[model samples]
Target: MASKPGILTEWPWTRLGSFKYVVLAPWAIHSTYSYLVKDTTQRDLSNFLIFPMLLSRVLHNQIWISVSRYRTAKGNNRIVDKSIEFEQVDRETNWDDQIILSGLLFYLASMYLENGSHLPLWRTDAVIWTILLHTAVIHPFAEHIAYFALFSIPMLSTVFMKNISIISMAGYLTYIDLMNNMGHCNFEHIPKWLFSTFPPLKYLMYTPSYHSLHHTQFRTNYSLFMPFYDYVYGTMDKSSDSLYENSLTRKEEVPDVVHLTHLTTPESIYHLRIGFAHLASEPHKSKWYLWLMWPVTLWSMMVTWIYGRTFTAERNVFKHLKLQTWAIPKYNIQYYMKWQTESINRMIEGAILAASDKGVKVLSLGLLNQEEGLNSSGELFLRKHPQLKVKLVDGSSLAVAIVLNSIPKTSQVVLRGKLSKIACSIALALCQGGVKVYTMREDEHKKLKAMVSNEAGHNLILSQYGTPKIWLVGDGLSEDEQKKAPKGTLFIPFSKFPPKKDRKDCLYNSTPAMLTPKHLENVDSCENWLPRRVMSAWRIAGILHAMEEWNMHECGNMMFGIEKIWKASLENGFRPLTTSVDPKPN
Candidate 1:
């Protein structure tokens, strides 16, 4: 015998709750059509034919709410618990905002398609001419001007006048919202055989079991209308069927409420995971060494083929500290050289995937990962994985913070690098701190000199100034040039390379240089706790600082100062690590 449909899964009238909506639906449609169209007699016949479809839109929310209430009242304890958990997770993560945005996009697409047919056949030539004029003469702004003049202004006037367009738009938005809500309600009474026999039906309408997986495991099944978008984006969860079955059939009692925040315990804390294109200690630039490692590289490739691209190092967890780290291994330099364009990107994507799997909140790019040609503040990763929940951070602000704090007040310093974004930020901070800065870049030096000279009551001269007390060598400086600094000068190198042992002239090294294995060992007893392996820690700290102070969303390339870093650390419940101080002014 076929089991009867549950209250939530019954026929359309029962699911809709009130019979009053059914009775009034015909009258509502006729009234709306009569108000909008002049020829009521012709439109009334058409409206009568499509009255059911129009009525469905008006009562969608009411039906959804009725079904939801029925399910909550009749479902087992475990089912109710799962529903509550889903709601909590949705609220805490702000997933509803994303849903609304996606719905708006769908609405815009619908509007565009509808508008394309609204014009008459005779007006097609005029439309083409207008497009050509916009393309050739107006260029980029042409589209913006056309959209404003043609659609936006007219739409505004119609909305203000309370026309048919306004009524239709409201109905469309409400329909979308109700459909999205319906997709989330996990009614277990849906027949599996219906979906199994007609797979394409799943694309047009979501089954309760199908949409349940989206709430539980958020990295997949993003589309509300159909599975088509999910399939195209490669974000459809394969285990959705099994998971849904377990949710429906499980006998064990589950917790009534499960917040996503509660899941972030010490054991499952979202790691600030970091990635690198090449290790700092490795000889990445040497072609001969790279070729020599080809055999080992081939073996690694076989291993990757068998397992996967990413190889995870043991998790680094500090007992007292709330922070943890995960390092994802990438291909060696040989593979990168052989497949120059694709190699590093593949490694980066693999690392990001691994981090996302581990539930990482923030993934920081290290050293070579930030190279202009590579990830470049993780724009590529973001573009490729629009469904990715993990935040990508470049850690530029943290690097700047460390650099600024290292310099003393009123000290004269020489900057050895082309005036890059980071370098410019450092220069601005130095000037604010009453420090005189000299630069190796002649063009930038001239610009700085002129600016300083032009300032009223300032008597500082560039060429006539005495030797700088400190020399700060950035990533652009070569090893040979670093060795040429004057004797007894306080040399600070920002690049990954360590200073020579025989260099007795330099007084101190910055935090970036201290990330080396040897230097880290001297500072802490954890010889295996390689700081250089996770150099993005500095950047993570810096970005967190910026976020706290400025409420900045993207921190990939933003500049930060020491004051902001210190305050941000205090706010975020962590202490910023202090490095060795420079020598006192002679």
Candidate 2:
């Protein structure tokens, strides 16, 4: 939205939401009906293609949006080097409005333009030209002509051109969209040597840096695709060439810490920073409307199977320290599959080695990537590459600290579900801290009692008897068991993924997390199920590991001092969440 929004600034079909595509459905159906029922000579190919072409434009713009957001976040060759806050995201969310407007205009132009139904062809009929040029060597020549129509002679609108073939029109429209997206993407991919080879090309084609000035300065460099008009009107920005040169010379960013994570669910794809802005700004959860996109979601799952490499999900800077987040292609369930163990380990190993080569001080394995069953909490990578420079962190120390701090000192805690390293550590710490730790499972109680001294072990009770209000839960906590808890019982989770909330009267908390300091920049979105500006303890631990300049790796059987980490976190300005989280249960 602009500073002062006015009439027509928003699309009339805005209230229609996602179903706004229905506005073009009648034209599409009528065009198809006419093409199929009419005689061969009377069939209008241009009119029939209007709907599909408009849809293609929508998809093209979407590709640019995703790619631009991803690239800018990575901070490689960025033109403007400015932050894209939630306001920028909301303002740009309606980028497809132009495509919708053009589709309606295309319909009206077909009725008023001369020979609208039977326009002249380039060399032959559209059908033959499309086939011969696509199958022969003339496709490149036709694209050059389209570029001329787009860059040199910008007045030629495909919707109004009476002397254009359908094939040439498609090419022209594609080239125009490609250039338009490139100019506004805020990423510099054009090389400086290209201008040196052909100096006149600088004025003919616009670069991202040139357009970035138009956005920032707002008074000059107003040309759309070409800078020729700016040059003619003497409105060309003075720093265009220098900015382009600087952008080309810029290098990719190097970070002090990297958190390696994976997809939590199939629907989490939409909650990525590179995905929908509205969804990313909030905690990740399933949406009812997402079921309508099941086909696309399924396709994305299939694509991830083959996308074996890691990708940058986010980048943030706090004070003098730089941080980054990289995501493995696998999902949460995939990490549990026995067959995927080897492949998953290979990906994690590769990412660790890559981060080491890039001079990253610490690499943290987040979520299921540190599952003991998968890689022994990242010990396999250490064994394979013992000489690696980057320290691997599982963040178990801080995770347990958060769980211990969350339990109310007055309430007895009922420890439930599958016992793991962190669960055992939390139980041990609570016993030492004089907090009663009760277990529903007899085997878990015996295992925990045997680990501590007789004095501390007295606090571990083996029974489902007491009605403890504070429940320290882990994965595999059944819904039936949760139904047994008292009303208003608070369930604090130690596991990475939270448990299901089966009882309405019972309260649940998000997995171990802490409130981030105001110094963290570009934190517009929540970290998975955690609340806004509240980061996962594991993530904050990695950042603290780098900031404290700790050289030791915290993976395998190693456990850092919990009290020390807690004090360091508080001293570094990462506060505990004052409010309890109650997100929709998984």
Candidate 3:
């Protein structure tokens, strides 16, 4: 070993730390020994001495780098810089490359050596297995030793066991390479020992056919060591499955040595089917196991059903969901019963239809749960008239009076609490610009009407039966109570209201009544068998008519109250409008 002058030269690390240099001394000594052994005439001593160490080092580098990168990539769900390099360089360090290079060097040197006739062996399999044994024993343990020398063993215990099998296999293949490849050799003719061992050795190394496949078309042809294992395990790809019928090139092929390059749906499903087959083929079949596993099977079935319906069925599920209730009109008794059961919905339907007929662009508001309304009643209305532009805003946004105050600037609808301020502000702004303001609401019709009191205000009208606070502050009122109100009060009825028992103070009048067309008509007439408040009566009638036409009973009566207030002011010679003191700025 010391006869090599280059190897015996002073170490590069002599100027560095003693402890670190001491560690590298063994490596220097080993390198010298490897150099000497390469030229040694004794094949057994050379192969036994150098091949194991070199193979182990190569495998150590490969497995450590591969697994380190795998862990790093898996942690972040992405491959970082070092991981990418590791993945690229991992398969390139096999025995064949090094062996070919070394063989060429040795062959060149042999021309000048004593009694050198020719090379012994050049087969790639012989080179690989020799390297394999080196890799198996040396790589993993060397990696652990190297890392531990630098860091601590406890820190790398996780990595120690990750690639042990690959290392062991490499060691086994390396031993086979020694016994078979270097053990028997002839330059010009087949060796007698090789013929004796060739059949059994076929199980241990790449065969002639496999070696050809690896060299020429390695992308799809990879069956290392034992081709049968590759076949049985379904790793070998014959490339029979074609993505394109006319192409024989295995159109989308992954590199033979690397498994990560290509991914296909059929390949994935094939693997899944293989897994399922394996599960089904279990030897110890038990009914109890099947019974316990039924829930998982059922869940998988449901998932598959959903997935199939989503992709394979080629239908828009959302659209289907929306139109489910409006099923193809059935001309049967069942259809008639459905129509009868949905009579109330039919009224809203009629209103929508009428709005369409009258050329009014109708849109539904206040319905937040689209699945509930749109899938049923609303969907029918929409499909019958597809041009309608309906929208669903969050109901919770308008739930409370205070929450209504903080509404984003984009909100257009006037919240219950902000109504008075918004009405006053709009009226004030528009009146200044010579634009008339017509503010409307439920019970606070009177208060909104009072906003018209501004001199510059063109025509401000609030059309509800009660005060601003009463409309929001109280629970709610009934149809009769709204109509029998005093002069300024207009009966603005709602489709439904909380019962009087629930909100007693919200009741607008002494008499009890429900919301019906007949009751609304009486409210429109404004003839409650009492002395005539002439302007109040006409204003109430006008309010009632508007509400009936627009379907805003509460809103109409509130406007009636405003009209009464305005007319009263006109009769008294146009008094300056006085608005109620609004609460603190929201």
Q: Give the winner by TM-score.
A: 2
Candidate ranking under lDDT, highest first, comes to: 2, 1, 3
Task: Give the winner by lDDT: 2 or 3.
Answer: 2
Alpha-carbon runs more than 4 Å astray in model 3: 1-343, 346-351, 354-380, 388-495, 501-586
| RMSD, candidate 1, Å | 26.1
Clashing pairs in 1: 398-542
lDDT of 2 by residue, 1-586 (tens): 2699777456788889767878888878888899899999988888888889998897788788779878877778888756656566666666676677677766665656654555444534443433333221111123323433334232133224334566666675687789879988888999888988999998778898998898899888887667877887899999998888888877888889999999889999889888777788878888888898899889999999986578988888877888889999898889878999889888988899999999999999899999988888888888888898999999999998988887665535789877888998988888888888888878888899889999999888887654787788998988778877877788889998888878888788879999889888877666898877888888888998988988999988888899999999999999986536432321
Off by over 4 Å in 1: 1-308, 318-328, 331-339, 353-359, 383-388, 418-420, 443-466, 496-502, 513-536, 539-556, 560-562, 570-581
Ranking by TM-score: 2, 1, 3
Candidate 1 vs candidate 2: which has greater TM-score? Answer: 2
- What does the lDDT read for residue 158 in candidate 3? 16
The most accurate candidate by lDDT is: 2
Task: Name the weakest run of 10 consecutive residues (lDDT summed) in model 1.
Answer: 256-265
Clashing pairs in 2: none
Q: Mind giving the per-residue lDDT tens digits that candidate 3 earns over 60-89?
A: 443433333222222221111111121222
Total backbone collisions, model 3? 22
Off by over 4 Å in 2: 1-4, 29-43, 111-161, 288-299, 580-586
